[model samples]
Target chain A: MKYRFNTSTMSEWKIAVLFLGYVLATILAPTTAAENILNEESARSASEQQKLGAYLTRAGNCMGCHTAQGGQPFAGGRRLSTSFGIFVTPNITPDKEAGIGSWSEEDFWQALHQGKSRDGRLLYPAFPYTEYTKVTRQDANAIFAYLQSLPAVSQINPPSDIRFPYNFRPLLSIWRALYFKQGIYTPDQSKSAEWNRGAYLVQGLGHCNACHTNRNLLGASEEDTLTGGRIMGVNWYAPSLISRLEVSSGDWTIEEITELLATGISKRAVASGPMATIIRQSLQHLSIEDIRAMAVYLKSIAENNNDDTSGTLVPVISENMKEQFAQGRKLYDTYCQECHGVSGEGVAGIYPPLAGNRSVIMASPLNTIRTVLNGGFPATTAANPRPYGMPPFQQILRDGEIALVVSFIRNAWGNSGSWVTALEVDRSKSGER
Target chain B: MMHFILLITFLLITPVANAAKSVPDTIAERVKACTICHDNEDKIERHAYYPRIAGKPQDYLFNQLRHFRDGRRHYQPMAILLENMSDKYMLEIAGYFSTLPLSFPPPEQVSIQPDEIKLAKQLIHSGYPARDIPACSACHGDTLMGIAPSIPGLLGLSRAYITAQFGSWRNGGSMRGQVSTCMSEIAKKLTDDEVNAVTKWLAAQPVSTQPGSISVLSPALTNRCSNIVLGEHTK
Candidate 1:
């Protein structure tokens, strides 16, 4: 009880001991998969099997992918398009024909690891064998067990529509040879158990890089380009997740982040659009450990310092804008000045101002015009638990009136969005984009 | 083990039992038209976004409708078609949706690039060691099964949606209250390749990524309110 230890000395001793233990373990650790497992007949219990199913759910992101564009949750057929091509997801029900009902656990493993079908034919790489190949056969088998336990439903599989060379299935095998490596998720024994857990989910199940990482012309992701991935046909740009590379949030705690991912609702931001579905269907069902793992891993990226919040497009006071200012000012004063302040700050959580919003002056202005005419909404997050949306003015406002409203907001206050015509709104509504 | 099962069973049934209390004695006047598209047993196939609503948490579903009403989440069809809706009616709709049992359909197997998978996995498993990208599983879960009431499941999400979201965060998209915007911060730290790699890996993973319910820590992860992109809703 009277022992006293110096902080520096204690730290030095701990470091030395850790290094010694690492060196010792490195030489004594088993060399291969064969050396790891002593038995093959072990079966997961009902409880274990259920937990295993939960594990597989996180690993596969089942609800996020399998759910159709507007179809049943986890029922496949959401069309995904990339520079390479488009692929429609398949169903996972136990149906003998339409679903994976006929496949064995071995077949499931093959498809995941080797990208090969139950009959031995190569499966398309879109199935994510690249990452899944890292999962252990034991884990894969557990997922299979969970699948077998579900009720079977018959839903016909859909064919893909990727263009030309992208349509070639055999070519994926060639690609696999270069990238796919079959094995269990290996934990870096040198790292902490927490770090290892993070690795398991990110690499094995969460698959965060698939969206955050940038790809080359051949659709290969470049290492340095992580968190800077290419944007698809939509005007959407995937942000970087490497905090060392950039910072995207003004402030976010580890716990706040986990809660956001779990419920799609947090004090900072609410999940919206496609992400809403992902949260409601996919991440929300994840276990507390997995949520923590995701949070821990994301928090580890705190070094990134890129904040493009007020990047550009803040409406400048220009000669032309000055010229149109009078007309626009009169319009605003007559129609909008009553509820909206002359400064256009807008009511909190009720009316959003155009001052510093990128979405307002975005290159594509559909959301703006549409919002003006149709009056859409924001999603529910903890910050603004109950939001008040704007009502559509299509019935009350004429086309020119809508145009004037849009143009004013686009250029008003600090807003820098370009002028928009009623015709542009009409074009967008007609599906030109 | 029995206790766990019993607890879950009770959790599942308690909400429905409470829902039954709200029904009016006059069955005809208190119509259940909402059940047509919101039933737990039926398969909603017309549109994939229309999630099967049965068996969901009543509070969660109600929050969504209120979100739609508040204009945080858009639902043109709902407002234009169901405008004049009362707060009570919206809550009623949410109650009906919370009764559906989750049913997963078969998955479609697609192909992908090997090199893409390679880079994606590298980032996913360990993150960019050179840059400090944390693994995705830290918060989402190793199994990715979400906890109850508030947390969402990560299994079976569409890669396109996932990628799009990360893109939104990168490009500075706003979500509810701006609290959950941490993902945007996390995404901002990633390189383009990391996004693509993670998205591709997620899309390609085996179906039903997780097996059963994953525990959740909603209160722990979603309490902050800094980064307010929009102070108020715009008219």
Candidate 2:
């Protein structure tokens, strides 16, 4: 008694109608902040508060920025170089003189919420208080408690090396007035609790927007959401999370996205470079439910489309390009074909397939070039303890050779990315920001 | 219109002058200072002071850099230059130097007595077995070119440089191998005359036509020197 009359088409129609209803519901929901709830979160048991603090610290990736190269954890001296200035991270250890030991819970809240230091000096935005301003008072106190629990280490924060006009602190007020907004995440009534939790973490503590959004001339983020752009000074592109043309996970299963968030490698994709650091230090520590929630939110935001991986469009190759292409094929066979297959289908779970990989076919060939030059090492999480590493080719391949091989992969197996040039490779090698 | 766009692009992309002026930031440009001493041209009349770093095995070169940085092998300027470098930076420098392909000039025919040549060859090829000394070929490949990754080649070095190294090893000077200081022990065992003879013969021998270090390492050598592992004992 099965009544099958184009069930797949019917399902698609149903999904579209449901999606439209959800969109309309979201538009009609009134936006409001419950400021009273912020104080209510603080009255937890001391031990429970400590545990939560530690977990939230991992969620926020506090140690990744604060700790210097080969220095003690949170005894901050890490340097971040940007076009605006070179900002040195401050010590957050509980040392009386050098760290945040003297700061009360109220003082900590003022710093996180108001972007002001204990002495009432306007703190630099480099500290990411712009994002931290959205963090709840309870979460801030928990992080503070965790810092208070750590053994004190005395290391004075180095002053940032900013250029003349930026070095003037008072000027930040103007920038803040124009771009900044102060508020905690107010949950949308239309969305589920899971979606709201995901929004809070991603928008506030995770600060995904920092690298994933483009910046304007004054170094303010151009968009509030993750329509990705090139991370200045680092040279890696954080591809858009919402676009079907880019790194959207809308088509991916809930399990696949959750696995990638939890372990840094899923069946479909593997995280590398800056994302690898985040996975190792932050995402891997989070609970499975929270990771799934983030995935759910991300998937919901992804724009719909027919599969970008399927159709094969023939590319125009010039006589000069043909010769270059031949040379690239030879290089690929010699070096890459052993791991990534002859047709660019890499081993599942171990070596990610280049075929249909969004990262490979990305408009900017920066990440592909970088992975080849610096080696692709996914984070060593509990799930994938001994992740197979891609050896760096910088020593073996010259700028031209790297360009050719990278361009070959991008264009092979129905992937239609732009050809990488030797000049771009040279620029990247010279550490061009 | 296209030309105007290109001009704007160039202006926007250019780094601030202060950033560009600070240091020779690229690994390739930064390593230019090394050529001032190493002078890795493979000349017939070689500089006797600095060893040619150009075509040395990468791990061998890497270990030497670490030794200099960590104070195991002391040269004040070398130490200062490498003091703040991370292991990864040192590896990059090593890799950069190791891949520079250069043709070795024929070895300079240093005048030596036939007796001295015989003694030197015996010590290098079949070391004094009674004194528990292994052949140079046991670790450095049969061609006297290095084994891939770690062990350094003994050929194409100046006689003076070779002699100085032996002296440093014997006298408990700055040079110290991390594994066991097996070199220091071997240096102590060899007589000054034996070292002198060995250096003269080594200097006289032709550099291997081989482009890079040989791939295989002998098992006997590995048992003798824990420091010279088969491949990349990076730590």
Candidate 3:
């Protein structure tokens, strides 16, 4: 080394420090950047999951059943009347002492998928866990996260007033063995994604079959899930979904079905009774795509292909029966003709048409009889806020008169359906399915 | 020849009797049918929301029937009933109800406070000049018994019915004819409180024993009502 300042050495030392700093940055920069990126990704996913959970909650109408009338939303105190007894829905809000606040994601998944509580206790079918059992774990977890985000409502769950034997929670395990199938919705590879999604919603979260399916004495749904059934305790008949002679018959276009679902009113029909409630609380809030998917799934179900010989078996009016038809005709003119129209072509968008109407000429006259007796009021929704209501003839018309008028509406104009007897009318009046 | 004449006479008399029996039966049946919903003797008010159509002015009844038929009124039942009926038939039906000697029941006790009653009375009698609200009694006779040939009496109607009618009018529920309805124009000016007040006051009024005579004075109508013109029927 020369005594004079060596510029090259100084430059070399400076280069060495710069190289060390670069190496350090290469090691440390990624750790910090990756951490930030991972954090951002997780936060984004959490929000997305929450948004989906909110949508799913709305689709299932959780607030409608969970929350009591005029009570805090999701602070479940609503009394749901059932054959088993009254079920006071549980608080699903995130309250540590009162609600599902302490429930982990796995615990939430178990409740929804296995129909069991966090403590491994069997849950009641009244919670519609039979339907919720088909919900995906991801969806269940998302719902849990969304619920946890809500302000913790410290409302205590009220005990159910269930009758004996059914009240035993242990017995529910046996019931679950018989009725409940624990599994996430398996997408059918052969079907479109939309169709599968619709199927999942209709058969699972929507639990349409809960009301629409016929239940045996054991409360298990019949093999044909959506072929129609009488709602237990509720006097309404959920019409057959797959029959050619009922509502949602092959005659309906997909648009019509979606329209009915979204707006609660279509050119063909209006949603009334329990169906109206479904439309108002759940279906209307869904996206058009979801509704169309549901419509597609519903329409794909085969129409009742059994060659209906009943169409050929039109009842010949006897002299005595002629008097009944005349009376029915007079009654229709006096009470019904003003709204239903002269030729049974109801005012478009206001009154449902009777001529060639599926509800009018359905294979089972039960729904028509119920509608006439109870009066069909279309659900009030955003689309049709002030719906026209059909006045109930229960007070005004006798059982015989109701039967006669029902028979007349069924057979009037282009409509052709089996005659409803006075005894049938009486049975319906007495709340028999 | 005498036997032939007797046979012809018998045929003529038989046909006449049958026609007489059937025509009256049809019209009478129709009229009697209305009483099912319109007339309930037990209740203080005849019906809950259904107005007592009996004893209304012939022209007023006819106009309402026309309005229902023509899509001016929002009632489905009335519209459907009148949809296919001829104007002549509507006129006959309106004439029949008008001539029926029906007595109005006394007003039911309203549930509003004294101040509310005073406000209602002011609106009905004096009206709020600041808001250009003509007194309800201005067109409806001085007693609110309504003028003949057009104006419907506000008395004897239930509070609900009055309130509903006002609401409907304000919301374009009565959108018939080439001209805007006078009721529609009048109803739009009313605040919610004014509507409640007027309906309460109007519904509480007792029906005068005598039917309101047609007003002779031609007061300048604030609004042009196509359906309200005397003797001028739309369709």
| Most lDDT-accurate candidate | 2
Candidate 2 residue lDDT tens string, A1-433:
0111457888799778656655665666523222222233344456677888999899889998898754679989878888888988899999999999999999998888888899888877777677777888888888889889899999997888988888898988888887777787777789887887777788888888888888777777754578888886677889898887788888898889899989988756888878887897789889898888888888888876885553565668899988998899999999888667788877556667898898898787888887777564467687865455565566457889999999899888888889999988876653421
- Candidate ordering by TM-score (highest first): 2, 3, 1
Largest DockQ belongs to which candidate? 2
The per-model DockQ list reads 0.02, 0.03, 0.02
State which candidate, 2 or 3, has the greater DockQ.
2
C-alpha lDDT of residue B178 in model 2: 51
Candidate 2 runs further than 4 Å off: A1-44, A307-315, B1-235
DockQ order of candidates, best first? 2, 3, 1
Task: List TM-score per model, in order.
Answer: 0.49, 0.64, 0.62
Worst 10-residue stretch by lDDT in candidate 3 chain A? A1-10
* Candidate 1 lDDT by residue in tens digits, A82-159: 666777888877778778888898888888777788888776656666667766776777777777666776767578
lDDT values of the candidates? Answer: 0.56, 0.76, 0.74
Clashing pairs in 2: none
Model 2: lDDT of residue A143: 89
Q: Candidate 3: deviation at residue B206, Å? A: 2.6
